[model samples]
Target chain A: MKTIEEINQKIKDGNAVVVTAAEMTRIVRETGAKEAAKEVDVVTTGTFGAMCSSGAFLNFGHSDPPIKMAHTYINGVEAYSGLAAVDAYLGATQPHRDPKIGIKYGGAHLLEDLVRGKEVELVAEAYGTDCYPLQNIHTHFKLEDLNQAIMINPRNSYQNYAAATNSSEETLYTYLGTLLPKMGNVTYSSAGELSPLLNDPYFKTMGLGTRIFLCGAQGYILGEGTQHNTEVERENGVPVGSAGTLMLKGDLKKMDPEYLRGATMPEYGPTLYVGAGVPIPILNEEIAQHTGISDQDIGCRIMDYGVPRRSRPAILETNYHQLRSGSVEIDGTKIQTSPMSSYRKALQVAEELKNWIEKGEFFLTRPVELIPSHGQTVKPLQIKRPSILVKDLKTKAIITATAQDNLSDVARLMVDNNINHLPVIDKEGKLMGIVTSWDIAQAVAKEVQELTHIMTKKVIVAMEDEPVEVIARRIDKYEISGVPIVDRDNLVKGMITAEDLSRLVCSRDDKRGESL
Target chain B: MKAWLNFSPEIVNKAVISNLMKNFDVSFNIMNANITPKGGKMLIEISGEEAQEGINYLENQGVHLTPVKRVVKKDNDKCVDCGACLSLCPVEAITIDEEWKVELDDQKCIGCGFCTSSCPTKAIKLAD
Candidate 1:
């Protein structure tokens, strides 16, 4: 058995053979694991995806006599300044709830700007003390100004991720990327076959203290990522869901901006696209076998993002082989599933990592503390309905007409409320039909007798529990003035008009504004 | 050989492109165009020996000529390749490859920047 010292010597002497996890797969397939392991000294694996739970800690040098910064804003984005006098943690998804810069820039962009050697406006407010009486400071900081800038991410790489599709009529803006309306398309974001955790399926190479390539810089594994759930169904010894994540730490100063990007998904907020690559030393034939796993063996379920729940329902179980083929079948409909993570970039990361190990610039580290192989699950962010629902948006004190009511009376009611449409209902408040001013005017011109004769019989209704956007699309698609909000039994609850939606726009802006 | 021109509604009925080809003895290849009722823009490659004269003739016909530069820029970070901008491209500048990722041909894209608004993620934008 060759020791790590022997591997180091071989690498130093330019004798060590390094292959990418992707290449090792083919090598192991062509020439059995025993031969592959003996020939290949290391296999590099990489992944690039949105890791929301990532952030960096910066220790800005003592500003003359610095006061303890209680709050901080880096380029108008709030950072966790609760650490010390000058140290702060800028979250990857911070100021996520708001504080938008030019429509969509946030903490991720601020971090990336810093990495690109751009000047960042730093503002801080602190309670005055005798030792350090300065309560506020407005300054500009470059990367060089920071004493130590460390990227200590709680989660970096996901083993696998769910592919997403929309079954609903409207488009879904999700972290999974935008899902097209009515199963128009599906989008998946995991690196899949090129992913780091996929190469080390059972955490054989990925564990605490494992040396890695973090955004083109040397980094190390810290611990289990926030929701590192290893307990998942295995198809060919590879977990089929988001499992076995890692907590990583690296010096942000040494990182490259090309591999580290900031992404903005509407409604979902800002996220960092962390490029991570891990080099796994081939200790045995088993290590080579694990790295050799194929794309067909790596499976991820295509989930429906249309469902309004924490755990979205999976529509189809698929593998990278089929997913990369560019389409998947959901409900017998041929839906095109596209990847969010750039495989072109992921491959480049792996190649660069392979070169690092070959040149003895990077080495492997045995785990100081390994993450549990099982017993973890993601506690989804409770989808709190702080915004208005369709029921809440309705004019509860609704005016209505019956089928027997004359067209003149219904038209008069519309003029009285300055409304365009009147909901026609039964005695039990169940919606029958809707009569607009146009319908009444046409009835008068045609000399029609009753409201049922001229009134539109086909009632297009909005559910009480549905979101406002869903109903808004209905109004736009049909060019209708308003829609009657109803319960499951066709019971007319209230009416939602374009005027109601306009009011929501003002209210949404109020809620989105940052607290002074 | 390359000319970028803008067409306002008043001058759109002038048939300046056809007039230039007939009068100046130049053939033109339309690389991109966003012709509509309100206003329009086009990027065309003028050919034949009299290409420069055709460009001058078209400009004299009240067509505003602009310089050829990057009119559309894609923020690769935000683009999910959902293909929302595919059908919106009047010049057929945006295409989905075998892997279903959206590829934008800047050469064929007119300065109209249709994909900017059509992009669900707002990944594509008109260069300032």
Candidate 2:
């Protein structure tokens, strides 16, 4: 047994032994974990992958005359300027105002350009105030111009992630990369055995104030990331899927452009690629054993991306060994497998951290407070609303005609009323049939004059009290544009078309700006 | 020489590839292919002394040929060796070398252009 201080002491005396997670695996295999722990003082792990929940907070120095900016944009991408003047948070996924360039260039790209020392345009708008008279300001600046630019990522370094595949007949463009149709390929995003969270599954060495390698700069773990959950199935002391996440923060000005990247997923959106590393001090034999976990022992679940839903179906479970082998079997068929995360970069990060430790340039800091390991799980969003029914929709008043009416008369009525569908009703106002403008065209071509000859008797109808979702599905299934609502006695009431349902959605969106 | 062969729907079911192999002394490797009953295209690399003769035979078979001078081109200066394009390559043409750098084999690339869109740095592009 040993302490972190003892390990630091050994490092000061130039006697501490440090190795990467990959090398540690071989050492633990050759000798046992107990013996390896007594020899090695630290094991460094790393990962580089797209972390969408990432952004940076920048305090652009106050302009001359001073402006309390309410709106801020960096290189056309808008940043949240809800804080004090000259301060804004630029999210990695935030798109540009112009949709044409938004997909290719996003906040992530701007962040990278800033770190690369490229000139960026800054535009701000503010309402005139007595304290700050300036209303508008347009200027250009670089990373050094900012008073403070800190990357406070909400989530980074997922413990483990699921592999994505498509089962449908069409290709799916997703954050998991392009999923080929019919499970043509599988893409998994994680450093697997080399990932930082995987090496310290229980979070014994990682928590608040824990020093880490963030985008080639020294940073610290803030707290638990959003959607972090420790209540998950585990095998060999490691979670099968994503279980733990860390919120990390670091000085953006000190970051290297090589480790900070901006990426665009086709048909999805822009995201940031973060390179992070965590060095685990082998204080005991148990810590040594955790770092020795190999790719064969780690399992990742396969998810079907074809299902466009929150909960996609689980295809199967496989290990990193099979994934790295280039293919895995899914339902008796061999499917090619790829990785969204960069294993090559992950190895580079681990080696860099290992070198930093061996050179005595980097030291481990005891966490100020440990992140909560229990009593944490994501809660599904609760939506409070009553189900909408067909009757609730603003349907058009029933337009009726008689089967005895001449075809020219029905055509004239349709042209005058600007209606396409007309319900043929009996003298008692009960619906008998339906006719569309297309029917009139066919009638004219056939030289038919009687409305009865052109009318469709087998009419698909809807009930007033039926749920709007049910009616929408029926309309899609029957390949119809509109349906007439009827009473129990088959009396025509009103008509609901695809347009009415769509209008309802638009109005609902206007009512709730950001709610789903 | 690497070339693309487009088979029309009328001759897609014919054994043109098999007859080309039997009649010519050239060897061929199929890098990528998307052929259906309706019609499709195939990218193949052909070599040997009779490679020119094989080209003539495919042209006579009513197959449209588009010589693949280049498929996807990579700018080494902009690439970060992050391996983002490694997994998306169906032909395994992109690989990480011992030094952890991404290596692209132009001869093996099928020119599907999947990696061009996924690259974070936009370092890869489809050849004009």
Give the best candidate by lDDT: 2
Per-residue C-alpha lDDT of model 2 across residues A1-516, encoded as one tens digit per residue: 888899888878878899999899889988999999998999999998889999999999877799999999999999999999889999999988898897789998898999999999999999979988999999999999999999999999999988899987667789888888899889898888899988989988889988889999999999888889999999989999888999999999999987888888777888898999999999999999999999999998999987655677899989997887668998898877767777878888899998888888888889988877888897877547655877787776668899788888889999998888899999999998999999999999989888888888988888777777767877897898888898779899988888888888788888798664
TM-score of 1: 0.76
Please list the residue runs of candidate 1 whose C-alpha ends up more than 4 Å from where it truly belongs after superposition: A1-6, A95-103, A329-335, A380-407, A412-461, A464-483, A486-516, B1-103, B106-128
TM-score of chain A of each: 0.81, 0.80
Residue-level lDDT of model 2, residues B17-125, one tens digit each, is 9998998998988877999999999988999889898899999989988998887788886776656577678878887676657788887788888889777678999
C-alpha lDDT (0 to 100) for residue A272 of candidate 1: 82
Instruction: DockQ for every model, please.
Output: 0.15, 0.32
Error of 2 at A3 (Å): 1.4
